[model samples]
Target: MNQDNRYVICMKWGSKYPAEYVNRLYNMVKRHLTLDFQMVCLTDDTTGINPDIKCYPIPELNLPANLPERGWKKLTTFKPELYDLKGTALFLDIDIVIVDNIDCFFTYNAKHEDSVVIIRDWKKPWRMVGNSSVYRFKIGQNTYPKLLTYFEQNFEKIRQEVRHEQAFLSNYLREHHHLEYWDSSWCVSFKYHCLQKIPLAYFIPPKKPSGAKIIVFHGEINPPDAITGGGGKWYRHVLPSEWIKAAWQ
Candidate 1:
């Protein structure tokens, strides 16, 4: 209910994604978000990030170092009393590119105060699974704690059942009656929505999807890769997209 408490928070960790990713995300939010809110980054290191964005240490997930990284650390974002953050919190993955005004992300769900809004999984439309790259939730003593607590207690069983953290979260939130999805067009997937498919992908340059507000880059491709049109493998070649370079800054 406190509109002043609105925050756009993101996470960054390790050598895979540097501080620049967080910095770019902050710049994007500042450019597109006309709403009054704070910008935050939760990470192990904050070197090179701009000071305007509030930085917070990522809470420990308490998992063993020997385990495979299936993005389980993201669950820590749900820790009931996360630092001093309160009210509507938008959790964004560092790899995403904002292509249009995102003030709607906060206002579109203004009426559904209890709904946990996320982007619907591009691959699995039949099931209620959602892509966690972009999502909105209240930042206090809501039902958020249960997601992390349940995973901590049942990691062995959970890791086998779900492919990754987003999959587990999508199903759990749906079953708990807290799941809501953003409009499909607002958060379009770059791989599925923008790039030409297969054979055509080789000749045609990636086109920015019309009316897309936030272009999500998941799995093998990222913004850097989109600029060069190299997906790290021969089969995934995309013609360089000029629009990605324009928006990523």
Candidate 2:
């Protein structure tokens, strides 16, 4: 592995998100990330993806038919020989929008190469839950073999015991004392950290929290909805955000 190689990885399978999201993400990453790196997208369809971004077929999980797909699909990235990629990898969810410079995500705690660094789940501060929207790990390291093996060997048991991929990953890293969190200000949730308090949310559009590098659209509020002002549920209301559009671009 080249000592300078850095990778930003994302996965897309089902048709929930379009290829434009991946293309936009590649552009955003290119704009914000100062390092010399490659953007890898694991997807079933690459028809409209930007040619600059490397696209690969989703790794095989070999999950049982009865198991639900939801978050479990992300585990495919843990394949020991993942797309022949090695070195540092930062995984970003398709819905996240990059804001400020993301150089810190790669440089911070560079010495701690063995720990799996992930954003802390905003809602579950007390529990050892990690929001996998953005996480950093070395390819073929730690969980690749350890947690992957655990899931494979205990396929039936995991199907019953774990609720989702993040849950299993969080607990596995917690047990191994390998779970590390990025600074709270680096990666924040759009709903929890940026949205205005309840009633104010209706009149006020979301703003980027100070020092936040990435805004994760967890649960609801996709980038398209935020741009078009269409992501409103009965309880939560989101006003159109031009700033979000600029950042997402």
| Predicted candidate 1 versus true structure: per-residue lDDT over 41-143, tens digit per residue | 9889999999999999989986667787778878787888888877888999999999899999988743455678998888978877888899998786554
Which ranges of candidate 1 are over 4 A from the true structure? 1-4, 110-112
Residue 15's lDDT within candidate 1 is 89
Q: Name the runs in model 2 displaced over 4 angstroms.
A: 141-143
Clashing pairs in 2: none
Each prediction's Cα lDDT score?
A: 0.85, 0.82
Clashes of each: 0, 0
